[model samples]
Target: MTQYWYNVRTHQVEEDAMSDWTQLIGPYPTREEAEQALEKVKERNKSWDPNDTDGDGWADHD
Candidate 1:
């Protein structure tokens, strides 16, 4: 299957790991998902962060 990556440096979706790994977001299955890499990251961070809420990188963990 073809995997997609989001290039943080250029803010573009790539078909593969054409650039440095540090500058990439992920191996998302679709281009649309890759395009929302930053949003996905934020959402995921909020889910994982013990103090994340309201997408402010901090939440009321109570």
Candidate 2:
């Protein structure tokens, strides 16, 4: 079975584990999920940011 990864730096899905941790987000099960990595991060950050009041103290100006 092939593995998939989302390249954080390039914003692209990789077919195998070819990138370093600083530039990647996943060993996702499918290419579709890998492609949505940025969306997933945004959704997670949205939920986490509100509850993370003690985190960084930056407000969401959006």
Candidate 3:
């Protein structure tokens, strides 16, 4: 099976893990998921942002 990644720097989806780690978003199972990387990230951030406001708890804090 092939792996997919989202290139953070270029906003492109790739089939291989060829970019730097800091510039990539995932090893998603499908190309479609990788293509919607920004949306995925935004969704995740939205879920986490509220918790971060308290500056406590799990302390993931961004």
User: Candidate 1 at 53: error in angstroms?
Assistant: 6.9
Ranking by TM-score: 2, 1, 3
Per-residue alpha-carbon lDDT of candidate 2 for residues 1-62, written as tens digits (9 for 90 to 100): 89899998888899887878789888899999999888787767766677545444344454
Go through the candidates in order and give the clash count of each. 3, 0, 0
What lDDT would candidate 2 get against the real structure?
Answer: 0.80
lDDT of 1 by residue, 6-55 (tens): 99899999997899999998999999999999887877778788766566
Pairs in clash, predicted candidate 2? none
Cα-lDDT of candidate 3: 0.80
TM-score of each: 0.73, 0.73, 0.73
lDDT by residue (tens digit), candidate 3, 16-57: 888888999889999999998887776666666666454432
Residue range with the least summed lDDT across 10 consecutive positions in model 3? 53-62
